[model samples]
Target: MRKAVSVLLAILLAVTGCAGPAERQDLAHVSYLTSFNTFGRDAYVYVAQEKGFFASRGIDVEITPGTGSVDVLKLVAAGRADFGVADFTATAITLAKERLPVTTIAAIHQKSLAAIVTLEGSGISKPADMVGRKIGDQPGSTNQVMFPVYAKAAGIDAGKVEFVPSAPPALPQLLAAGQVDGIGQFVVGTPLIEAAAKGRKAVVLPYGDLVPDLYGNALVVSKEFQGKAPDKVRSFTDALLEGLEYAITHPDEVGPILKKYQPTQDATVASAEVALMAPYVRPSGYSGRVGGMTEERVEKIIRTLVEARAIPDGVVLRPGDLATFG
Candidate 1:
């Protein structure tokens, strides 16, 4: 009788495709850092959380707001955060300059959105106009870090332009108050900045217009995490990108979703930011797979940085050294 019962239990287990309770209950917990506050630009992580995308991949993600891309990169390198979303150019420069143990697992935006934004009557309609003017921004933000390169490309003397340090939330207000001539911001930030300006038109000088080859934000992970759990890294990246695709496609829905996580964020402004960001996420005529990148393009970016004096010429880097492709 006992042997018959044992055989029956074994048969039932096989039929049900059961695994050990421990194996079934185990889930990887990770902390994810966004490049900035809970703006629409960083809403996809919330989308992933709300849609159960991370949970479906056996991950429990704690999404935290980062101060800036450069700060996010530093935190990820220090292993304070398991993963981070940051600008590709900032990460590349840091990797070449400091050899931080970080790698980009996926590309978010195909083009750089960095820009110098100014209000009407600021007399800063063009890059050259920025010379001898004050530009306010977070000290280490992508826009501030890359300003010199943008200035050089636009035939402006970078040294003459003064960069005023301020918190991210204060920048738009600073510009509106006429405390600064311009602010370093991304192109998608137009709606929010314009709203702050209270009827003033924003004159945006986009960095991508002059430096076309540069890529934007990306998913970065520390080498330690990548080595310890490569499969988890891939799973997390897949889930995050899935959320990004959905967020960009459903901007209206994403606005409410971001508002749910960040009550301070205005849903309408969030929606507008996502709408403006859609074209950069999937550029026109780009047939490649989503989040996919190539070595040739990365190499070109490095060379561009070198030529622009963003990185030391003596420091050598390759795509494989900074990112994992395929």
Candidate 2:
């Protein structure tokens, strides 16, 4: 009986040994900042975390909520966060205006989300309809700042529109109350604005209609961090893109995932927003792999900004200086 038991033990040990030990995982901890508050659009990070994509890549990511894209870019440039999601146009404008030690690693939304939003039946249907109308404008929002450029592309007189200065939160309320005809806003904010308007439908005229080449959000990292840990940067980008793909494909699941991380976020609204943003994230006719950008397209974007005077005249900004999906 003793010999038989010994043989059984040896067999069990052999079976276990054949599988070998688990792969050595040395996790690298990193911080990631979203472009804005814990909205549904930003829920992809949570999805990535829940799916173990980061873990599989030997990364432990800490997610933080950001105020806005410009603010997120500043924090990332200052090394306050290892990586951040921000608007590519905002990044380019800021870079042109002031030198920051940051570079975009991947493109998230291929087109700008900026738009002039209003409630349906406001009698504003097109860009030309905005002339002589009152638009609630947030002081430094990208939508407001780029209005003149949009105005030019749409062939509307910028001076004709009346821009009413208002705080970001007040704009939606102002629009809902019939205090303003329109508001400078992002198309993604439709769900929230419609909620604020008490079920009133939103009419969005996306700037992408005229500014077709403009990019929306991008994955950013400080130049210092990228220089020091290129491999980690690549791994993190891959995992994040994977999460984005999953979130877009399964938008209904994103709401619950976002609610898990941000209890204040409305799950229904979050899901709706993800569904709305999916098209912009992976627009039709874009042949490159997800998160990829070409130098020629980047140059076209720069030229568009320059032509619109969004970027200062004669300010040299090469594609390589702004982004490299390498």
Which candidate has the highest lDDT of all? 1
Candidate 2 C-alpha lDDT tens digits along 1-326: 99999999999998787654333335788999987667787899999998899999999899998766677778999999999987788788888888799999888888888899998999998999999999987555567667877898999889899988787657778999999999988798899899989989999999998888888889999999999999999999999999999999999999998898788888999999999988888998877777787788889988888887878877899898899755
RMSD of 1: 5.4
The per-model lDDT (C-alpha) reads: 0.89, 0.86
lDDT of candidate 1 over 90-198, digit per residue (tens): 8888788788888998889999989999988988888888888999989889888888778889988899999999898898899999999999888999999999988
Clashes of each: 0, 0
Q: What is the lDDT of residue 271 in candidate 1?
A: 91
The 10-residue segment of model 1 with minimum total lDDT is: 16-25
Off by over 4 Å in 2: 1-26, 131-139, 157-171
Q: For candidate 2, which ten residues in a row score worst on lDDT?
A: 18-27
